[model samples]
Target: MADDTEANRERGIFIMIYLDYAAHTPVCDEVLKSFEEAARDFTGNPNSPHTPGVMAKKRLEEATENIAKILSAKKEEIIYTSGASESNNLAIKGIAKSYQRYGKHIITSFLEHASVTGPVAALKNEGYEVDFVNINKDGSVDLEHLKELLRDDTILVSIACVDSEIGAIQPIDKIYELVKTKPHCFFHVDATQAVGKIPVSFQNMDLMTLSGHKIYGITGIGVLLKKEQIMLEPLIHGGLSTTSFRSGTPALALCVSLESALAYTTGHLEEFYDKVREKNLLLRRALEKNKNIVINTPEDGSPFILNLSLKGVNTNALQAALDEKGICVATKSACCAVNTVSKPVYAMTKDKKLSLATLRISLSHMTTAEEIERFLDVFLEAIKG
Candidate 1:
């Protein structure tokens, strides 16, 4: 019976439709090919002084230049890290430790990914005061409360450019303007979810984080965009190679892969968004036909993610049903999926039951209309059962 079950599971998975792009995306064919070719030729330490190392160093510099061009930033401002989580940690903890003399107050929203919250939580235990800005039902940050929370000692304000759970795009420009009143404060944005799907600007941002995996690049590689004047205490202590802030030998292949990923996405971003937007609309319309569901993502939110609650249904069971049907979705961040509840969704609705039933359906540019239609049929059947 177990052998039969395993075979059945494998068969079902073979036809699965992936709708979890916000969690992670497969590296594009172009990026993979570029990385494979570069890895074959550029296998040397970027920090080494040998001839082969010089070739690796050149590749690193070229990748940095390309990434900076995509982000509208200076090449020198980019500091590579393992991924966005580390970048968030380095940005938040580094600033808290280095700039606390200026002020010990830090502010962030409840909708932030765990990476930001984990570092902020650690600082609270060390005597730094943290204010968690609340969000409206639509998942947009409460600007009035954020303005009220600012103080002379508020040295850093970190906000996610887009909420990965619900795909709500925060008004960073306005937040940047309001934060300017504090004089000593610096603005940090986690653009992990928004980078490839939407436009991200560094106009008034002091620090920004990006993850390569989220944009169809290789895993274990990311970028931290820091303004030239902003100083941070080093998180990793070693010989400085990439930037004075992060110490380690750079992964030359990963850098080249990330550069390729960013260039491909940005080059076709508008066209990609249009296609995904249509798929999102189709999914939303199908869900609307079932009054047993409530859409949580705002209409103005990014079309890449659609969050909804299945009334009178258990989310764990729903997830299992979807899995058996070879459909992939998420209840929250894949990082926090082990927990039974979604803190971010609960923070937005303040309704435990609604949060418990929430499902995140994320789309990619490659999503097809047939996949959305099939998902709707299976979803309605599962709810009825």
Candidate 2:
């Protein structure tokens, strides 16, 4: 997922058909209110021992416990980081560095966001033997192939609960079953795209990462849930703050906002999901008729995201055309457009041209049927030429 601030603001769109919720979302009004109140009332460093600091620390812990409760994790397991990128790095590098003596092999899939793939690549450079797990044609992990990749020496297996590009939900529980049989292996999941949109279970995961902005919370804060027995080398080294794993002044307001956002998202998850499903089906039915386009999303993919590619058209051009007419969509992840090709699409379809022409039109509960209709009209018009 990416930032909404980058939603073609340069085009100065006053009216927008924002089909890019998978990239990022607007902050929830209630979550924003909670943040403002926290900022005003809790104005002390949580690390300080003063009265104000004590009060602030108390609220921060309260927020942490609230977040942990919602995720079915222990309060002590929550580690706040700058965002999901930092959390992914901390989990991947931290675990690899901490357990290198036990094993040097790691496994992941092409469906992971840049955060997971980047850290895994960094580990590869540092003499860790890394393997790419094969994914099914629908963009889900090929568990049979994962079993082949698993070995006594495989230390970490990191995959996302949902692929942000294709919205394919992975079989985390089944995968965890395979990974845990190896005593040295640790299972990690980047649930950034799955948490609030769907019911994400923390059952068999040793480490999990989630972003606040992806769930209508404040942007700079993210949560990483680590099991009690897992020891990770600290990514940030300094005086202890909330946890020894990552160090910084506790973000009182962001923490409050995160709690509020999760509460709201989960409280009405089924409502939001069912509504988004209708919009997804509407778009899918309309888009499927275009012979020049190929739909990449799976039959059982998350309704919040749809991936497709134009047969001969350059996706960036279509994206720009849509932007010019007040529609916001994504050619790739917010951070990955420069790559100019969709790696996930290639992995799913094995067609180089289609991968190069992919566009991701993501939906959200906030989306209206009118917006989808407007988008289809504009999108079809733009591609006609």
What TM-score, over all chains together, does every model reach? 0.96, 0.96
Specify the highest-lDDT model's number: 2
Candidate 1, residues 199-317, lDDT tens digits: the string is 88887799999998999999999999999988999899889588899998888888899999999888899999999999999988888888889888889999999998888888777
| Model 2 Cα lDDT, one tens digit per residue, 120-199 | 99889989999998877878888899999999989999999998898898988999999998989999999999999999
Lowest summed lDDT window (length 10), candidate 2? 1-10
Model 2 root-mean-square deviation: 3.5
**How far out, in Å, is residue 277 in model 1?**
0.5
Each candidate: RMSD: 2.3, 3.5
Runs in model 1 lying further than 4 Å from the true structure: 1-13, 337-339
lDDT of each: 0.89, 0.90
Candidate 2 Cα errors over 4 Å, as ranges: 1-13
